[model samples]
Target: MKKSILLFTTMFCLSLVVFAQQNKEQDESSDTVKTIEKLKYKQQPGLALAASKIFFSDKRYSISGFGEFNFIPVQNNVNPEMGDLELYYSSLYRYATFFGYRLTDKLIWNSEFQIEFLHYKTEESHYEIVIEAFFDYLFKDYLKARVGFYPLTIGYVNNNDEPVMFYSVNRSEVERLIIPSTWIEFGTMFYGNLSPSWSYALGFSQGLNSQKYISGTWIRQGREIRFDLPKSISINPQLNYTGVKNLTLSTSGYYGNSGQGEFIEISGEPVEVKGKINLTSAYAKYDWKNFRFVTVGTYGQLGDTEKLFELTKDENGENGQVLGKEVYGYLMEVGVDILPYLRKGRPIHEKQNFLFDTHEMKLSLFSRFERLNTHNKIEQSLEGLPRVESDMEIWTVGLNFNSRENIVFKANYQHRLNKFNGDQFPRKNIVETGIGFIF
Candidate 1:
């Protein structure tokens, strides 16, 4: 079944590409529509697109953002040794607001601050935090530059992580683990569209803190946020193609040194290691006839792990963990707007008007599968590292109800299987529901 699904996805993608080129003129014209809901950023992510109204209207300043709330009824969760307890039953995941302004026709400034608690830890009280603040200087659709803090576009969620943008109540596991969405850094980016068919982004930003590396998550634990950006830098680059109607394909890459001036004791000697990270990913999304298909594949490499693992060692160096030299994962899902199939009236595709222009409610069903191994390949398993691969596999089935263009309610059941000790261990399950909205 997995093989069949993979084959179908491949064929589906090829078919879309061929059809898009065959009818390029129609798809190309769709780019010029600067409707209040569909203004063009050419090179910005969905968060930027969220301000379409501000960009299209005569107003010079506006406020916008998104909020997500969720409730989880049951979750067996990770293994006991992993020491992860389930968050409480319910919580307001995030309340972020975006502040946008048009400095001039040629320049734009956008900023964002969010109030959020880590899972159900609202008792700790998170302060209002600045998630993003940037100045965009647009010379044309073909050339642009941005300065200050921003996030990368290495994967779908990294670009469009709003609650309503995806079918699942939580972000996909593969994206969260391997690609790590909401991964932001203080940086400078140059981006623009070569044409209506092609867009690209290049960013140089603060690097990670290598000392924080750990097993099971690789470099995901190394991300940091600070008022003073570090000197070590990471570079991220992306290229996108949207020549097909309702179809987008992109490939993005990241490479950087994660040392951040931290020194670790390797062999009883202090050493400043340039623990580098290299990652690349390919993503695709297509919507047609009330059906949407999404897929992403990512591969990554970590440098100086042997020494970095030395940093992760306990004071006695007895139970130190392992970090993989390489890691990879992929995810795939399809969603169908079943409301159209269930209706007694006209078929959505046959309607004379644009399918997306409709304000009617929609009910959708979706299922997704993901496989990842943060410790996929490593030399002789020593300490806590496994001799055989330690990997995770997940399956999720969900429903989404869109009552309006920007509001969504969703629920999903997720099951997890983890492989280690030459055995497959069932890692509980997660059942959750949530609501998401944008303004």
Candidate 2:
């Protein structure tokens, strides 16, 4: 089934490419249209195209791709006494393809599909794909409106390509295991530069719910937690302000109610479970000559309620069934970049040329701290699923070598500590290495 779905997706994309190219040669006298026609035929579909100049052209139409691999060695001690500490492996396949075309010089459309955790083990499958699509209607250089499935504009770390930007092949453990990455869903947004160095986005999207992918035998992703909110919907608003040529500050927030799904209570009566979630974030970044720094912090809240559970009662009303409890959690992180020997012509430094330049050899040292906790509350109406809560922390450090602005190689290590009250899971320590480039 998965293979068939993948095949269909590939065929559909290829058809779009061919159709666009065929239409490009039509007798369109407009230069704007001509430019877009040229772009339609030149988009690079995979990582192999990153070095192709045609894929990076400044025409109104554009296509780009990114790919990265991560490897982690872990020491598990959560249930150490249950057994000897075990060594484990965690890796990530992060990649994305983006395409855009102009409807005029001022009106452009863009779409992107991103893939992550390409090979994480699950009871059903070791790999799964997450998709994000976008359609932007540009009004001008500073403002645009969009409708599609896109990542919520929450944090810088969540939006940027991690592999091409950082030395560590993996995201901070806080970001890795807690705050979901490549997190996207159906929605619409208003985005564009509000002013010079300043921009904003106001969007409303469908919140993630677990029931959508659950089957009779398995819960697809990893764990089967009932996020009982009906396609929990959310509203996100954010603003960015730049006071200097190389520095910008941003802040954003989210509010929504989730409906996990419908279930029956032990009392033989049916009830609906629904709750709310909220999030807020603030971040800043600075680039001064060869020095760079960035930091972001976020807070989130998950709500629980007894009224969200349900049960179907017989005429005599004898208690016979119950459902799982409610759950909630939160997370945050901060990091910085320090380049000591940044040189202009090195290969590593060359990869990031559009974003940075080497006056000297490039060196970066950075670290991040994160935290997350979730609690499940039991109700007499629900049974089987237990009330559980957990606390987790992650610390990371790394050195980045920029051979040029568009190329880099990096190595880093992390120590993760997890404490749980529901189950005796162990703490873990991990190390990672990575290399990336962009032309």
Candidate 3:
């Protein structure tokens, strides 16, 4: 079944590419219709072809920034052991500044510095810093080289997360739990377009640290702040196609060893165990008239985990690092623009005023469903070890109001269902609101 689906996706992308090329040729043969089509395409929501006007025409240098703020007014605590309702006031979710410079037509550099301030009802407030810097050398339309620290392209949101590009107050649960968002690492990458509508990226980077590979979330093992350099490496590859108008398809994966060439002392002997980790994911997006749809699925596995458990055991002679042999997650969402319907025959272009001149005001209602299991499967024969049940299902319903192509206001309600040790686990339902902008 999986093979069939893969084959169909490939064929569909190829057909779209052929169709688009034919359309382009026909448009070139005409004049009046071509102009009208170009204007219509530029008027589409979420398309920002003129954003680069801020940069020097000679393309010497450029600068940009983005920020988001969130507020949580109401929430219900589901910890049966506690009898208190939780309330989180507000927070500076993210603030980032970007810089870019072009050394020549074929060589360029880009960098970003981001700050995050997080606060919780039961946890202390803290701040985090993330930096991404890279240089790109373009050889041709089919090939380019990049080196430095940048976000790994393991999934869609990891590299393409702009504030106005998504419809949620917060990112999806699958992206946060299954694959780390804004997960950056030092690496060398090669990427470019394979055809007019298809592209690919491949890279190698530093691997994760097994010592921090806990049971509930393996992604936390990322060596973001290690004092020493990583001895092992990871390979990442991705393929993307946007042949069809308003449609996109992508697939990506990562493979590597997280052991960092460490030796474990077991039974009075030094033993070497290479703990391997593998992950793969695929996603698709389609926009039709007033409705939009998106879906994504991912799977991950770890090898030699039983030996890793022994090496990272707790002080009580018990293995606390019972890493799962398998983990998986998926999410699906749908959204619709309701402002057109509410206006009763008034077109989007007519609703624009001076403040919203270059963009049309939009109101969208969206819903997302997600499921994930960190402990989908575990190693057997580990005597007296308790099973870890980290399965969860989540539901989010939200509304997004876009004042412009680069600014938005969002509100959402989120519900979580958790399972632990084969029983229902207490969780929370939250009401969240936020505003985000980019320039």
Best by TM-score: 1
Clashes of 2: 56
List clashing residue pairs in candidate 1. Answer: none
Against the true structure, candidate 1 reaches a TM-score of 0.80
Q: What is the C-alpha lDDT of each candidate?
A: 0.69, 0.49, 0.67
The candidate 2 region of ten consecutive residues with least summed lDDT is 213-222
Q: Report the C-alpha lDDT of model 1 over 1-439, residue by residue, as the tens digit.
A: 2332343345434433432332233334557332223222332543434534355546677655666667665333324234212212233355666777998997888887765543322222222244788888878888788888777768888878777678999887678767877787788898889888999999998877776665655776676677775858899999999999999999999999987776777567888878889999999999998899999999999887777766666779744546777899999999999887787586544322221324457899999999888777674544455422338788899999976555688999988666655432324477888877665
TM-score attained by model 2: 0.66
The C-alpha local distance difference test score for the whole of candidate 2 amounts to 0.49
Q: What is the TM-score ranking, best to worst?
A: 1, 3, 2
Tens-place lDDT digits, model 2, residues 73-145: 4344333332111113344445555666666655555565555443222212234455545565656656667
List residue ranges in candidate 3 displaced over 4 A: 1-58, 73-92, 221-229, 310-319, 347-358, 381-389, 421-426
Residue-pair clashes per candidate, as listed? 0, 56, 0
* Residue 38 in candidate 1, Cα distance off native in Å: 12
Q: Give the Cα error of residue 348 in candidate 1, in Å.
A: 13
TM-score of each: 0.80, 0.66, 0.78
Candidate 3 per-residue C-alpha lDDT over 111-136 given as tens digits, one digit per residue, 9 for 90 to 100 = 77777765544343546788877787
